[model samples]
Target: MNDLVLTGDRPTGPLHLGHYFGSLANRVRLQERFPMYVLIADYQVITDRDVPGEIRRHTTELLLDYLAVGIDPAKVTIFQHSAIPELNQLLLPFLSLVSVAELRRNPTVKDEIAHSSQSAVSGLMFTYPVHQAADILFCKGTLVPVGRDQLPHVEVTRLVARRFNERYGEVFPLPEALLGEQPLLRGLDGGKMSKSRGNAIPLSATEDETAALIRRAVTDPDRVITYDEERRPGVAGLLTLAGLCLGRSPGELAEEIGDGGAATLKRVTTEAVNEFLRPIRKRRAELGAGDVRRILAEGNARARERAVRTLEEVRVAMGF
Candidate 1:
């Protein structure tokens, strides 16, 4: 059988261009060739439970975002984390396999703990990677597409697989990381593209709104408008967005503009982004919120079947 491929996004906000390039586009292809699962990790969202209502809205919105971007339910499973309790059940033994030092060393968890407002980080937060490992392994996923920052999670998953097999029986495969080619697309302010940062162009944003966001995107202060990732990261970022949207190389775009001011760069970037978003906006409207739920409902049933089987095996191994 083809290797299982699994990946997903948090339900904090709408999917963005970075998501498209980083993994979703690849997922669209992988589903045709392999067993694929796209998870909307709502349970993971509780790492910061400050805004329960926002999470509720985005859980449904996340379904729309995936469908709008061409993730077909027929091609791959797309389920929310909350719907799969079996995966959560596996988290207990998996967490026992790793030490606190190992969990504390997880860079993603560390960054989250440092930035979050919570006075004390929960075990869920510290051992989040193990939960993530459960998410993948429960589906028997053998290949996980993730960003550079998430390679560490894949590593932890591999360790979990090894420990499980050594202690119990050989059941899970060691999943490999499928890293993408795109540069890490920073937000408008040049920080990570995140909803809370208020820097992302929401997939649901209108053409005018998207353009306006691009206009305010930061550019290099040194050269004013040159596209040099190393020296002019800001301008290079704009070029990256335009290049990804227009299907042109960033260098080609820079050469074509030839000393264009930041305004010119922003204008072109805005136009390219607006054009790209137009179709998605229409698709999003057509799919509607109700349709999104229907698709995810179907996906959840499919995902649950596979997850239930895996958990049964896990329970038998643990003598449950």
Candidate 2:
């Protein structure tokens, strides 16, 4: 079996700054060294959402963001989730291998449930991790790049892969979690940065939009800037963002903006963000729906070929 990578995002919204340093940048570099399959997880959106509208539009935007971020279509097989039926089919046998109690044991799921503070989480949401394993193993992914919070899901995938191979034969390779180097980028308000919170800076945002968003970033009244995250998270968050954009350290950046106060910190952050995103913005603007559709068409076809072969092998191994 060919070793590959499987990584993607739910098409709930456009890609954001947190996504950039968290996983996107790493994926751009990984594609060059490995056969990477980027999935636009449109199907995963409905797992927690009440009404998953605008998914097609969001999926197209996601493709555009992938291209804009230098994830070359030629090297990365970027495919949408629903387009490949065989992938989800793997969930049948995969889910049967795990129990409900085991799924609840996944820490990510528990955290999400507590975060949402809702008792109405659907069955789909509960079984989401098992579905993720289908996404990974269908591509024969040996490496899954994820943040610390996502490690449990990958662990679940590893468990399912191991169990399947032990019972049905050695048909799948256990995928490893390639943890991200960057710490979690917090919201401008020093809280969670999510679409629902309206605190994240999307990659598709215009230069003016970026500046406006940064202008409102929460920062303290301290005149002398210093990188003390525990005491001053708001200021440090902006510093962290600017540092990532300019490839500098947050402490060094804090020194540069010394005594400039929150205004100067936000200004520097705005400039750094705009300057870094200029090229990516240009690329995102140049891309169109036509470009997105054609890329997905070809990618989905290629992905189908891969999924079909994997499924056939799985059937033969299981005497189906």
Candidate 3:
């Protein structure tokens, strides 16, 4: 069996520092070791009924971010999810293996519904986990890199794969979730780093913008810079951000900062984050629009070839 890995992000916005440490950095490394498929999940964006125009723009922006982060198109297949019809085709059978009650019980899906603005959950949103299963199984992915929150989705994927195999012979590999060691980063306001919240520092943001965002980050009123997450979540969050950028533990940095206080912590974090993002910002600026388009074209073609083979196998196995 070939070593295949599949992972992706919704093109809801530009990638951010939270994304880098969360998953993008891992993709850069994994591409070197496995035949990796990094998808631009355009269809998944519609789970919330997002604007089509915005999704198109963000998709290109995301592709640029992937390139800026050293996800070599030459090594990794980076495709737009909507471009692969086979993935959508596979979703129907996978849905049959799961019930509405099971989908409703999914913790991840429940959290998303609670967070979304819709009064009634869209059928698309409710069934997206099965859609995600199709995304993974259509590629015969053996490994999926994700954060803790996404573990439920991976579980659903495994269940769908197992059920399909038991019913129609073995046609898919049971993909395993590869969780990252780094903790998820919080937004400037101390909540989850989200684009809609206006707290995220986009990977494509200018150096000045990044520093400005850090300056506005919430911190504690305490005089001493301590890393107590419960009492000083804001200050601790900033320290966590700084630590990720500076290669030090948050507690260690908090102690090193000593009496410099919250103001000092913010200043140090701004400097470290800017210095770290300098090269990425510079490289992103240097990429022309034409370069991004060409890369996507090539990647989509390569991904389609593999997806076609997998879907063909599925059809033959199930007598489609």
Better of 1 and 2 by TM-score: 2
Best by TM-score: 2
Compared with the true structure, model 3 gives a TM-score of 0.94
Of 1 and 2, the candidate ahead on lDDT is: 2
Candidate 2 overall Cα lDDT vs. reference?
0.89
What lDDT tens digits, residue by residue, belong to model 1 across residues 181-279? Answer: 756877888776766778888888888788778878887544345567776777888888888889999888888877667888889899888898888
Per-residue error (Å), model 1, residue 117: 3.4
Decreasing TM-score order of the candidates: 2, 3, 1
TM-score of each: 0.92, 0.96, 0.94
Model 3 C-alpha lDDT per residue in residues 114-166, reported as the tens digit of each score: 88765666899878899999888877898998878899999999999999899
User: After aligning candidate 3 to the native by TM-score, how far in Å is the CA of 199 from where it should be?
Assistant: 1.7
| Residue 298 CA displacement from its true place in model 2, Å | 0.7
